[model samples]
Target: MGEHPRRRADAQRNRDRLVAAASAVIAEAGPEASLEEVARRAGVGSATLHRHFSSRAELLEAVLHDRVRTLCALADELLTAPGAGTALVTWLRAVVAHAATTRGLGPALTGYASDPRFSPHTMIREAARQLLARAHREGSVAPNATVDDVLRLANGISLAVDSLADATECADALITLVTDGLLRRPANG
Candidate 1:
């Protein structure tokens, strides 16, 4: 028998729900967590989770795509802020804060070795490139800095923070120091 139209739509909804819930859960639990656990957290059947993600790597990739989109949107919105320095600072701080909470992102998607097209990472990089270019042109960021360099530094900071047992202060300090280095300096200095 043909599947009912309502049934197909409901299945799609279940898939979307599973994807979103799995993203959050995996960010906390890492990619090795059981699919049944993900399903339970998502309030969906294990079969439903499998239908959407198929495998752990697929779910991880989907989560990275979602996060990349979110970060890119944040960069786009921040780029239009009243002050360029303020915008850069705000975005950097947001990245650090986001990094502190989200596991595996530093190593998986944001690193220099990772493929830019790995998930929606290219979009995020392009967004960062545009913002960093503007920040440089506007004399808000260091002239010689590339977006890749910034991301590398951010990834390094995120990794360092991730290792500390109680690193809230350390994370904040490191992010602030990096932000200071990223700032533009006057020619006369």
Candidate 2:
């Protein structure tokens, strides 16, 4: 027999809470944040958290998936905004901020990056490509910058200074440097 509708709804609610709580706890306490605390923050018990996520790795994967979905959605929204170059920079900064929260999942995320089921990898790349193309046509970005270049630079900046005491400021500085580099410049005056 199939599960009851109320039971299924409850299960879904629990799962949603766990995922949201995990993201918040991990962001505040890093990847090693306790699952028990996540449950507590979600107003559930540890058993409930485990019922939703079989393991810590599973929870991490869910959080990563959620982040990717959010990033891709933001990219789509930004594409329609005015100023291609400004939109791209805004998207890149958001990516960096997302990366900051997932810093502890570095190796696991790397593994997921190779998996075809992770659509965020493809979606992000396509978004970057379109943004870069628009910026190039508008004469805002340098002619030679590729999607890969921008992704790498942004990812590198996010990872490199994420451990610093003033990580936010450091990230802002690095992003500015990258933006300046990507921007087109005129011939000598």
List residue ranges in candidate 2 displaced over 4 A: 108-116, 180-189
The per-model lDDT (C-alpha) reads 0.72, 0.83
Write candidate 1's Cα lDDT for 32-67 as tens digits. Answer: 656788788789988877788666666766666666
Clash tally, candidates in order: 0, 0
Tell me the RMSD of model 2 versus the true structure.
3.4
Instruction: Please give each candidate's TM-score.
Output: 0.74, 0.84
Best by TM-score: 2
- Model 2 per-residue lDDT at 158: 84
In angstroms, give how far residue 135 of model 2 lies from its true place: 2.1
